[model samples]
Target: MAEHAHTHTSTPSPVPDLNRNRLPTLFEVLSRRTLPPVDLFSFYIYMRDQQRSVDYLDFWLDVAQHMSLCRHYVRELRRSVLVGTPEPEKDSKRSSAILQGLGEMSHHAGPSMYATEKERDQDAQMSAFLREDRPGAHDSPQSSNGPRNRPSPGISSSRDITSDSNSPAHTVARQDIRASAEKILYTFLLPGAEREITLPGSITQDVTTAIEEFGRDDPEVFDVAKDYVFQAMERDAFPGFLRMKALGNLIPATLIMRLILGLVSMFGGFWAAFILIFLNETRQTRLWLILPFTIGVYSLASYQYSLDPILALLGFSEYTPFNFSRVREPYVRKLLAQRAIMVLAVTILIDAALCVLFILVPGKRL
Candidate 1:
């Protein structure tokens, strides 16, 4: 029997080199573009001051760079997962390596770091100052000046880059992040201006304004609009005309129903009043007529006032018009109530005139 031989070949990974000479220059550009590190508790003024000096092109470039770093990191992770080891090594070196890679990825997306008791006082003092100053010194994933994550990963691939750049979902997300950054940047740029930005109902605009204006000359109102803006963007898609058709039908249907009820009540009230006046000698006829007319009036008034208590008490709707078909709001019912009242009033007047005419003209009831 012949001895068998096997040849094994390993392919080199395509992860970008972090130690490239240009990387330091990139960090320098990033430092110039980004707002300088300041105490989160007292960062408003400092943020405004530092951000004003940012070069627009540099700012966008830095954003692009951050996006690229995240994209490359994800690609490397995907590759590693695809090339996973089939058998576990007892020493578990590969497991440790994978964990280290994951840690590096997390660091880029981590919240702004605060000093800890374990850190040397000097290191803590120098951390913010030296972050982008030393360039390659902090370029490592484990370093203090390591790159940060953007809202999305940047990739040159038509699919990834195109989706990030142009797809509605991704585009809106990037726009939100960009808009947040811009809000802070612009606020700092024009510190003396009084600008009012609309915020969502969740955040109190007055409180936000008060906090920002505590020490500043001009009260800069920072709206917690992100929750509002993103929520508006992410809301279940508009549902279009199909969803609206039912709602649209409601207004017209409401108006029509009210008009119908009003006409019926109006004519009924007129006839009953005529009959009661014609037969005034009978007490039972007068009592029966009054009870139903009062009920009909009450029912109509209640329907109008159900949505608008103020209007109900006032006995008229300010937001709605008298014409049934012209009303666009849910206030169609209110218009109907108004119409009912007018019809009842007119019927009473007519009945009074008919009684007077019969008495004066002679033999009118015949």
Candidate 2:
């Protein structure tokens, strides 16, 4: 026998390069431009605050609209560094810069970081100092040193960004506002309440005022306001279940009544058997057929009554004559035998216990 020649070939597995530069491509940003400016801006701000580069912000923004449409899109974006089709490397930086500029412009109209009362007081003092120092204050539109002034469109006294408050765009913005308001209300206001207390009426008043400030473009503001009112009513109206648990006085009377009725039925079953067995021959034959019918009717009635207590109470009188008859069909006989065994077992157990107790006790009386 010729010795077999053995040959081994080892194929090299591909090693992923960890050092490769993986930045967001320009195509990702351009794709996200299909989303509404507000949603795009919001997503951009989130990415920026997280220290993600402008390229990643663009990629997330492009995928934002698709987020509502497909759940998989979010997972896919998070899994991959570059989502969507990648553009040429040269154009990526320019695309990122444009998106960043748009995001900055959209955020410009929002309240300043120093809009609080303390900040406002400091601003007032600074303005007074500037006025006194400069004597003739040249507050020019081009002056960068003066208070940062937003250009007025002169549309209305409220200085709202949009003219038509009821537009779809405005409704979307109002939703954002309502979400912010809810966060503030729940986080800051609705904590550490001991008992059911009505919400301060001023919270509702403040919400109403906030809605008005947003103007008619967003009816959702009013909807959110109404929701807060309803929530306040709910908090005030319902007592906590934990409070009622301590009382322990309110036993479900209906359940107790059902238990009594069940005990009564057990006694009735024995009486029904005795009456049917001891009756005259003609009546016995008649009752023998009627007993199964009665049992069938009572079982059905009992099943229905189990669901509703009022019906059970009203129909209790009619159920008294129901009796169990000899079931002939094999399937039915098996069911009846099972039920009879259960009843007999319970009865025997109780009787045996009583007999044992009686035997244990010293009795003089015969």
Top candidate by lDDT: 1
Worst 10 residues of 1 by lDDT: 33-42
Candidate 2 local Cα displacement, residue 225, angstroms: 7.8
Off by over 4 Å in 2: 1-200, 213-271, 277-366
lDDT of each: 0.30, 0.28
TM-score of every candidate: 0.22, 0.19
Model 1 TM-score is 0.22
RMSD of 1: 21.3
Q: After superposition, how far is residue 14 of candidate 2 from its true place, in Å?
A: 36
